[model samples]
Target: MQSSSSLFPVALISAERRGDLSEDVYRLKPGNSPDGTVELAVTRLGLAEVAESRGVPVILLHGSFSNRRFWYSPKGLGLGAYLARQGFDVWIPEMRGHGLSRRNRDYAKNRVADYARYDLPAIAAFVREQSGQIPHWIGHSLGGTTLAAALGGQYLGAPAVASVALFGCQVSRTYWPLKIPPVEWGGRFILKRFAQLSGARLKRGPEDEPIGLALESMRWHGLFGRFGDGERDWWKGLAEVDVPLLAVSAAGDRQDPDWACRKLLEQVGSEHRQYLCLGRRQGFSGDFGHVEMLVSKAAQVEVWPLVERWLKDPLTPVTGAQPEVLAVG
Candidate 1:
């Protein structure tokens, strides 16, 4: 295979050995988008030394107001660490303006469409170039929604994705007030007043989110909303996606409810697809919330194993025969 790094200038920003984990951080400059705005930073994580060369490659995408640290903490107490120890090649990328990624020229205007069309393909190319494999993508919240947009738009096709697993991702959730023109316009007016939202102040997460994200979301969920980019209809395009899929929804997540999540999953054309809802009714110890479903200690034990199983084999039928599937259901 040709080296993708040669096609795009990718700088090795840093490399560190932390006990059992070898962290290789890289920065790729994909230059400017179609709008003539340059993206300064697109950073990716590679945990390779301890990774099993024979194991499948996996990329973990953090939610909004987050970075690669959501998958791997400094203390090595994250899902990325757990996967690396179990022999998977884990690649985590911090979107532009998040974590080590510096704010770009279009930082204030950055939206999910930009991420799906530019950032993700860049990350996928670099990861494939390095690992020589199509990676399984795992994303949370906005990260998952971006993945959906990429697949739905056919921006990142089967050549780039081996499979996808979405956590707390949905597009069907109705914002009734936003459906009202006056209300929608009013909300947009207020959001445009601010350049960005403070993650620390809002207690959303560690990093801030651009107002552009909020703006685009409002447009999508508003009255004349449809999930897609300026080029294609993402929501409608989802029916064409043929890759394997694992859609996980947290029942306690009022943010992105189970029904909506399942609706997104049902829209996908993939024959190899599974849906798992985490709640007490499903026999899970408790109803997992948006973040807690993945970040909490309970997820470490219950959810991680199911993810592993899905990665290994996504076609397994959920005949309600398996304990893990039942619990995850």
Candidate 2:
């Protein structure tokens, strides 16, 4: 069933053996989205070494204005690399127009809706085809939001996702200006003029983000807005998702506060869901920012192990005190 959607052939774009880290990059030109002209460039990072015991497949989705490097640095020193060393079949996917994934016909109009409905399912199908198992998903920031949208919209369902770990993600972030009709329309008017937002220009990250994402977000936060596309109500649909969920938040993340992240977790209907907050108040070494919570050295020491533990046994809540932060199981 997973292989059915292998509509576009995956081309092995690059294969390089870098020390202990084996990298095989693939590119999938998956036709197009509902908006006829919007083709997709979905790139995957597959670790080549045959695992000692065929570990579980894990897919890491990078956030907005970012690329596959968010999970695995070029020097083989990121969470994805660490997981590969630990015997996990790690697959890092660069979303449309990010990294090796080139822009499509409707590049300027690309939105999260397209990502949730088309790109993710295609990635899942391809991963399931190769791994022969339901893959665990780890998404950060906007990546997590897209994951939630996919789950909530029922575009990606059980037997496709073994478990999900969301880091620094929430849809409830209030944009005060968008609450007003004039401001909302005005902002959209201004944003639509740009084809894409440059990461280098913004100094936010390495990759550029399509203006469609900005427009989509504006619609979501606009007055009388809701969290879903025209077809589905993702906010309402979230209650139907019943998988092992781990929503992680950082106290110092002004971008996505713990309360909002927890709110997203709370809406899920998962019987086995855990909320982990990283902060000094929670006994963590220090308060973590949005990006640092996953990429920083402290995260590698403290949070990465916790993430591994969760992926290994998501149903088993992390109980008792630990040297790390306290998690609401």
Candidate 3:
């Protein structure tokens, strides 16, 4: 599907390699929901030229408010395109309430559980069924939380995940008071009323979706450091996940503190986990805020390479097993 919005061409070395990247929309059958039969729409970026040569599949999930288009910015911050160049099948799925997937026509009907129970599992199953192999999973912010919840046994069974990478996941009790009040109460109330009136459906936008909705979603989950309260028991769910895990944090991110992320990594039962924090002093890529890490120009230089190295490593248990503990500095 062609986007009516302005196209900012991504940076690429050669035109021929650039031509190998293709984008398309896909519909998924999410089985059943009391609200209705749920169908999810996803935007896929398939690298036909490089994927066959590399022999790995990578899937990306975006945070709330933003859609898959966020990955294809003009600065070459597009995660899908960069991963495609690395010779991996890159798929970016539009969550239930956002983008073309808003087919329910009722925005209020959109639930976070749709991501935990439906979207992530469906994408994993799709990759396994189609490619005959389990793909590495990476998610940021809300997307990361959804993946963590899924891996923690909320949806699909464990062991189905090969390796998991999370960026900016807050998994501690202390990090709970950062929610912005008006956004926490007002956003949901508005969306609930909006969904009731619109019947859970909203049209695709020529302009960006309202910033209030994004702020509300962030606040509702305490991602902005206001109330620090979360809609789900994500920390409890995360403790149950057993897989090769990598947790990343940004020193400057208020939404997810460096300590919260470290504490989460320390608590995981899996011995096969690594933790890294990036900033200017660390000689990392960009001095980014919460959203910029995945979409910043320097992400290609600093962030993606670390992720690529971890993904390329064999999925074996780390030699020295450590009990799950939470540590922050």
Candidate 4:
């Protein structure tokens, strides 16, 4: 096995020699579409180093209002770099309307459903075409929801997702506290008026910065305790996912409460499932917030080990003793 830091030098040197932007660098590039083109930005890491080691490929999906850079920041967590050092190919995608993925000059419409139906599926296809294998799927928040939707038969010719790991996603309508009131009671008129005034547009981040986008998105979705209930049917698709699931939750995450994650496991309908609660024993004083789990400094030492152990375990029936858990909080 090679050290994580060893994976980058060669690639960096090669890129410099060839005048090519290294994978560890971030860039906003144009994406092809039947109608025109879209500017899709992404942060590539552990390309030459991990690929040289013949590691398993992993694709990371960012939450709403976030871009790929979320995984590269010091506070953004070290999962991508750590996994790359662990010999896994990692690709972080910026979904449309967020980060670097923006619509063509002529078409600026941003639809949430379109992200599920188009952006995610295209990313999956791109991964398969590039790696010739189905990469492991990991997501958080809206990203997790979108991935679940893709696996639930929402997309055409969906790739075979090997395994799935989700953080902060819910299914039941009960998990969502918002509901439409009776139209006869004038609720519909109020909603219509509100929509008109607000416009059916995707919320923009406070700035073009990745973390800013993340914060803004969380705020818009009421994940920070601002909005009412989320869409109940959004999680119904999880029932169709048959892959092994590693569902992690933050005890302090007020956005997607721990109860929602627990319910997701109980009703996910997957035979192979594991649930992890972070900061439970500490009275929720840990740094494992909704987004911090993937971006915080402590995440590498605290969270990645569990993920690695699960991924490295054999897919076959149990044959050995279970691994012991390490208390991080």
Best by TM-score: 2
1-329 per-residue lDDT for model 1 (tens digits):
33237647767777777667778777777763664444334333335464435467889999999988888889887888787777778888888789887787768899999999888887888788888889999999999999999999888889999989999999999989999999999999989999899999999899999999999999998899889867799998999999988899998999999999999999999878888898887868899999988988988987887788777776674433323342121
- Candidate 3 lDDT trough over 10 residues, lowest sum: 4-13
Off by over 4 Å in 2: 1-7, 35-53, 319-329
Q: What lDDT is obtained when candidate 3 is compared to the true structure?
A: 0.60
lDDT of 3 by residue, 1-329 (tens): 43222221111212223365755556665554454545566555557554444457777777655667666643334777777667666667777656656555434444455567656776677666555677888888767766766765457445357777788876453423435566456555655443232212443322233333444344435644422224445446656667778777887888788888777677666657777676765555445677767767677666666666667783532211212222221
In the order shown, what is each candidate's alpha-carbon RMSD? 3.0, 2.8, 8.6, 9.0
Local accuracy by lDDT, each model: 0.83, 0.84, 0.60, 0.54
Backbone atom clashes (below 3 Å) for every candidate: 0, 0, 23, 5
TM-score of each model, in listed order: 0.92, 0.93, 0.72, 0.67
lDDT of 4 by residue, 159-196 (tens): 55777778777543231222222322243233333311
Error of 4 at 11 (Å): 19
lDDT measured at residue 209 in model 2 versus the true structure, 0 to 100 = 94
For model 4, state the Cα shift of residue 249 in Å.
Answer: 0.5
Per-residue lDDT, model 1, residue 236, is: 89
Model 4 spans with C-alpha error above 4 angstroms = 1-36, 47-53, 74-77, 104-109, 154-159, 171-177, 180-236, 282-287, 314-329
